[model samples]
Target: MHAGTSNFLKAFPIKFAILIATFISLLLVGCSDEAPGAKVPAFKAPDSKAAAKSGAPGGKGPGGPGGRGNKTFAVEGYIAEFHKPSGSFQTMATLEALNRVELSAAANGRLVNLYAKDGASVQKGSLLAKIDDSELKAQLKQAESSLHLAQQKMERTKGLVEKNAATTTDMEAAEASLKSAEASVELIKAQIAKTEVRAPFSGKLGFVNVSVGAWVTTGTSIATLSEVTKLKAKFALPQRYATTLKVGNPITLIDEERAIQKVGKVTALDATISESSRTRQIMVTVDNSKGELIAGGYAKVSVELQSGRTQTIPVPAEALTLDKDGAYIFVVQDGKASMRRVETGLRTPIAVDVISGLNEGDTVITSGLISIRQGSSVRIREIRNNTDYEVD
Candidate 1:
């Protein structure tokens, strides 16, 4: 082949390739120009003053370049005010029978008889059930026979001793034998009495756990007896009110489970306050002769205490925050949130008693607490009453 011809062929291919790339580039430029609004302008640096004013980098917003200004938070505010005294305090209480006991077998034997039916009312000392007492009775008879023999021997020995036919030791031995026989008789009689389950006091009986002819041992529970004529509601009160409550103060008992309400009177107060709970134990008595109250139930006990001061500064419970330092609240001071440490007292479901560190007209921030910082600029977007604030 000729060298010139080959070189010409290679140059022709390169020229063709260049032409194809140029055509493609021109096609792309034409497409871009035809597209609507596809043009981008040249970049330019933003003005410092405009950037700062718009809260961009190096602006007045919090955590910005300068870090000099705090972010303004929009929050709901509450107005503190005086609240009326509640005049009473409520606590959960448990109801108990004035006299309640679990009847159990005192001696081990077969339960032979159940004289009183379940839920039956009985008089004091009434026979409620009986265990098999045949063996005990037999033992008692044997002891009685022994007692009779000892008595006869003692009489003979006394007569002989009186005639100086028996020594003093013989008479003493006879007396000892008689006393031993008497003790045995009494012991057997006591055992027999234990076999008979009698009502300790007049009360209604619970369901018998054991049936007739069931073998029962000592301390085996047979049934429960409760004198429901009167009930005692037991509850605890705060230690602060220990001295204010008396034995005769009237209280209201509400059994929410049964929807029963009753008036009761305080009957007893514990001698000491419970250190663990910081409360004083108390008991209130209520009549249940109509069988309205149930033993072993729960009740809401409301104790009427002396009315507190009419003017009490109360704030929404959610407005208060706690930390290692103690409870503190955020109040708007000079358009900024200011943390004020506070001492709290009696609390209600919706409000807290601010004993100090807060004022009646203070505006407390109740919402947007998570975004709030000490001395952060705050804007009150909504106003709420003391008890109308939202939690969290």
Candidate 2:
């Protein structure tokens, strides 16, 4: 019985060991299948530290993704030119006639003769208009008769006084009577001369305002006569230009309507400036041999300033810039723009004369200057076309 019980216990122990081995193999298979389905956290890409070091936003380098490098700008410029005058010209003051008069008779009389007409050429002392002098001549004849009688009586008294037969007071009374009669005759003859109106100077008579037999008063204008062989042009200039405009300064006169050009010289200038306009009056004499220029016509005068051997640079007018520092321009070098302050001289619509602050051969940006600041990059698109400047 003891041997049988011992065999049962050994079999039981072998069975338990086999059951434990089967359970361990099933557990190992389940673990291997679950390990294939399990997901580890996704591997993230490393941040672009190199891009951050480059100062690009969002860790991106230059021109990478959203970054932008230096930008290009368009601009324009021109080559400088120089100008030299052939000859200098001066400015002049205008002129006027020394005397102007209208001839009319004082008394109302018949117009005996009309010697002058419109545009009639006359000489000084020539008879122009004559009135009837018959009444004046008759008065002069009567005075002459009385003077002759007085002179005979005075002669007799003087002879009597010399012969010691007449008193000295009687000779004095006869002399006084003769003098009075002679004065009356002379006054009548002078009245006759006043009836004949004569030309005061050599000139061309204007339109005849009076006709023959036309009654005229003392102040009535008979005709207007002016000497138009030469014209006097007067102009007012600033007081500062007084020294520049002196006697004998040559000037160019232009008639805008007729397109006629004339040359003249300054004849005189007012010594003092006018208190009202603060300008000095200058006069010039222009020869109008052809009588083309009229006295009341308007004219343009140009005075050439004498700038001796001055260094000047011509630039485009568009390149000029104004600021608190006066005027300036932009200069381009090595694809960058720089500002240069300049003093400007004569300026036209298209070009300007640079007096200072820029040297010859320096490149100036004509366009895109207003949009660009100092040290900004720029790309020149094309050069501007060459243009001419007009001087007056």
Candidate 3:
């Protein structure tokens, strides 16, 4: 081959290789513009109104092509109703006697006399036990002797003064002495009274914590005395119900263990709400004149806010939602889910009392909560009563 021709052939091979590499790069760039099966289309300006209606970046509205407009969440709905009202709320309460006290020894001494029998009824001011007041009686006798002597001396001093045999100052001193002796006698008698244990009120006695001859100090418990003519149920109520609960409102007390139910009346309420628990203390007084109930037992207390029949709208509990803003629920309005802030009262396993923000005969969305949003289109596949809906 000629030298010039050979050089041209070698340069041609290098140029051909460069052309192949450029073609491969062009193919890669084309592939990068779209997925394997996708086709690139011409660009078009998004319609502002349609984009706003869709609430999305694309102009395809809910009903538009390539949009979620036609999509609707299938959910269960419940018709809220004004049902016959029952208890406003139920809470655990502690039962207390109308009057209860632990009788303690007023004076420190050995119990010389004790009438200790459990469940024994006693009368007010009755002597239950008498302590050994022997030393006190001796002191009283000594004081009486001194009192007698002082009385005699005072009479003599008065006579002397009238007869001009004694000074007025002397007579005054004698009278003062007589008063001092009388005080001493009374003091000894009061001390003797302390040695005896007397019933402060008419009630039944508990177990005798001390026996005769058992030495006890002041404030030592002897027995418990409880007046069970009536009972009090004490419980705490949420502060939100403070306005509805009044001093004379009726309440129901239930002893589940004994299956006993009794009606009671609100007697007292806390003046201020508790900051920590946001609740108010309540005391309900119940008639126990027949001795049907025992004190110091627990009871289930239910409060009635109204005098007679009450009506309140109730919704399925699952329909209720809570957030930092407080409780809310979703109601189907115009075939779309609309959220409503609600004030709720009592709640049951299946239903929640809607105090406000909802009305009777309103449709509440009970199911498909996870897939629904505010203003989302919803289709109620099944409509049921508020109490009939079950949470899945």
**Per-model RMSD to reference:** 10.0, 15.4, 7.6
Model 1, residue 160: C-alpha shift (Å): 2.8
Q: For residues 217-280, write the lDDT of model 3, one tens digit per residue.
A: 8898988999888999999987646667888888999999989999999999889999998789
By summed lDDT, the worst window of 10 consecutive residues in model 2 runs over: 61-70
Model 3 CA lDDT for position 27: 92
Report the Cα lDDT for candidate 2: 0.76
What TM-score does prediction 3 earn?
0.62
lDDT of 1 by residue, 1-392 (tens): 69999899989988999999999988888888557546788899888777777667676555455553557889999887766556778999999999989999999999889887888898999987899999988898899999999999999999999999999999999999999999999999999999988889999998878889999999999889999999999998886567667888888999887788999999999999999987999999999999998888889988776553434577888888999999999999999989999998767568777878888788989998877878788999999855553211
Ranking by lDDT: 1, 3, 2
lDDT of each model, Cα atoms only?
Answer: 0.85, 0.76, 0.84
The number of the candidate with the highest lDDT is: 1
List runs of model 3 lying over 4 Å from the truth.
Answer: 1-84, 87-94, 156-168, 236-265, 272-280, 286-290, 298-302, 306-392
TM-score list, all predictions? 0.61, 0.54, 0.62
Q: Which regions in candidate 2 have their CA more than 4 angstroms from the true location?
A: 1-99, 304-392
The true-structure Cα RMSD of candidate 1 reads 10.0
After TM-score superposition, what is the CA distance of residue 93 in candidate 1 from its true location, in Å?
2.2
